[model samples]
Target: MRFVDEIYRLYKGHFNGDEEDIVAIIVGILEEQSHQDLLKLVAEMDEEELFHMLATYMVEVMKRKVAMDDERPPATLTH
Candidate 1:
């Protein structure tokens, strides 16, 4: 539950919908991936490596968000 809360906090503003729903969505996506390999790699990772991996993933998500925002036209102010 603590881990779920942490993930929810990390992804709060970045995703749409409620925190629980978003967390479930993320978990579902991961479950659909080649998870055996991911599990093996995670088992071999040290704490620092895990931290770096999470940080990198967050950075990539942020970059994608920025790119998507950039594609939208700026809001105009009308007099």
Candidate 2:
């Protein structure tokens, strides 16, 4: 399965409300795997797998501003 598809399968109901969330979820799904393991996994990926990884990380960030309307500001941003 593609990394993107696997992410959807494993985290099917974990909320896909935001593109940024999708990016984070993809990372979360692959989080903490060994670096060598990741390299090995990535090395075997074909163009599509590569897109699954690359496109997943392709998110909209810092567009206009880093904050969202009605979204609570993080503690770091509060004071």
Candidate 3:
């Protein structure tokens, strides 16, 4: 599987019930914008942009989780 696919699979069980759209968006964005140097770009993305992207997707996944009712955890990028 691709890196993004691996991420989706790894977190599939944690999405509660809102993963489909999130996965589609993320994969779409990555496939379109993250070309051959995806890893390097991810590592070098500005803090704001990186976290924004991370938080957006996380919110999508956590839609059914009570813990996210009013809280957003720290963002992260896994290689």
lDDT by residue (tens digit), candidate 1, 1-79: 3444665688777677667777687787568658685677677777887898899999999999999999999999999
> Model 1 off-target regions past 4 Å?
1-33, 75-79
Range of the 10 consecutive residues with the lowest summed lDDT in candidate 1: 1-10
lDDT per residue for candidate 2 within 40-72, as digits (tens), equals 878878988788667665544443244574375
User: What are the root-mean-square deviations of the candidates from the true structure over C-alphas?
Assistant: 13.5, 8.0, 14.3
lDDT of each: 0.76, 0.70, 0.70
Write model 3 residue lDDT over 1-79, tens digit each, in one string: 2555676786676566676767675676677764556777677667887899799879878885766755886778899
| Candidate 3 Cα errors over 4 Å, as ranges | 1-36, 64-79
Error of 3 at 60 (Å): 0.9
The prediction achieving the highest lDDT against the true structure is 1
Model 3 residue 21 distance off true place after TM-score fit, in angstroms? 13
Prediction 1 TM-score vs. true:
0.48
> Candidate 1 has which clashing residue pairs, if any?
none
lDDT for position 40 in model 1: 72
- Stretches off by above 4 angstroms in model 2 are 47-79
